[model samples]
Target: AQSVAQPEDQVNVAEGNPLTVKCTYSVSGNPYLFWYVQYPNRGLQFLLKYITGDNLVKGSYGFEAEFNKSQTSFHLKKPSALVSDSALYFCAVRDVVGYSTLTFGKGTMLLVSP
Candidate 1:
């Protein structure tokens, strides 16, 4: 079984300030991590993924995530946040092997103020 957790319910950031959204995971085996963003009345949009190789995975819209095996964490980061970047962020995980299903976190709301 695999699961993901987003500790913060909401993340508030200024228009140009750097932002981070924390995520942690637990799985029986190796994990495939992913991040998605959702806008109001819109579907989830793919942000980035961390499967293998680099620990730092870059994604769309200047967003990136750092995969830390030792810490079992995959935190999302952006150098400069925009007001348009405000949305619901989700973290998901699935086992690399076997019949594991993708599990998503409760989601963290990012509020960027102009």
Candidate 2:
């Protein structure tokens, strides 16, 4: 089985500050990790993915995530926060060595205050 955990239910940041959303996962083998953001009443938008390569992966809208194999963690980061970035974020994981569907965390609502 594969699962993801987002310890924080919400992350608040002031505009122009950095932001982070934590995530951890458990999988049978090497994992495929992903981060997505969903605006109110909108579908999930792919943020970034960690398949294989440098542990640090960058993606859309100034978002990046680090894949730490030993810790089984993939935490999302943004250098600077923006009000528009406020949304629901999700961390997902899938087992690379096995046939399985992706499992997503409950979600983390990021509130960027102006």
Candidate 3:
């Protein structure tokens, strides 16, 4: 089965507003969760990761994520967002026993309007 899934195709928010990008995962043992943002024609920038310990993890660019063991979910959240925050976001999980590469979701586009 695929490791991670992002339910939303896109999330729209006005500039200076908060935003959330939903994500869920299925992995053996403790999952290595990571959130990345991709701008057009650019590589994905690592935002945050939840390797172990602490359900609530903070990250770059005023972003954070909550890891829910019961629900097998990790959702990304940002407060007081900016238009610069608008980008294609991807949630990924490292393999339990495979290569070091991570499995990514389809991606959720966050559009911060003016």
Best by lDDT: 1
When summed lDDT is taken over every stretch of 10 residues in candidate 3, the lowest stretch is 93-102
In candidate 3 the C-alpha lDDT for residue 108 amounts to 97
* Local accuracy of candidate 1 as per-residue lDDT tens digits, 38-98: 9999999999999999999999999999999999999999999999999999999999888
lDDT of 3: 0.90
lDDT of each: 0.97, 0.96, 0.90
Task: Locate the minimum summed-lDDT window of 10 residues in model 2.
Answer: 93-102
TM-score to true structure, per model: 0.98, 0.98, 0.92
| Model 1 C-alpha RMSD to native | 0.7
| Candidate order, lDDT descending | 1, 2, 3
Pairs that collide, model 1? none
lDDT per residue for candidate 2 within 1-114, as digits (tens), equals 889999999999999999999999999889999999999999999999999989999999999999999999999999999999999999999898858888999999999999
Pick by TM-score: 1 or 3, better one:
1
Model 2 bad stretches (over 4 Å): none
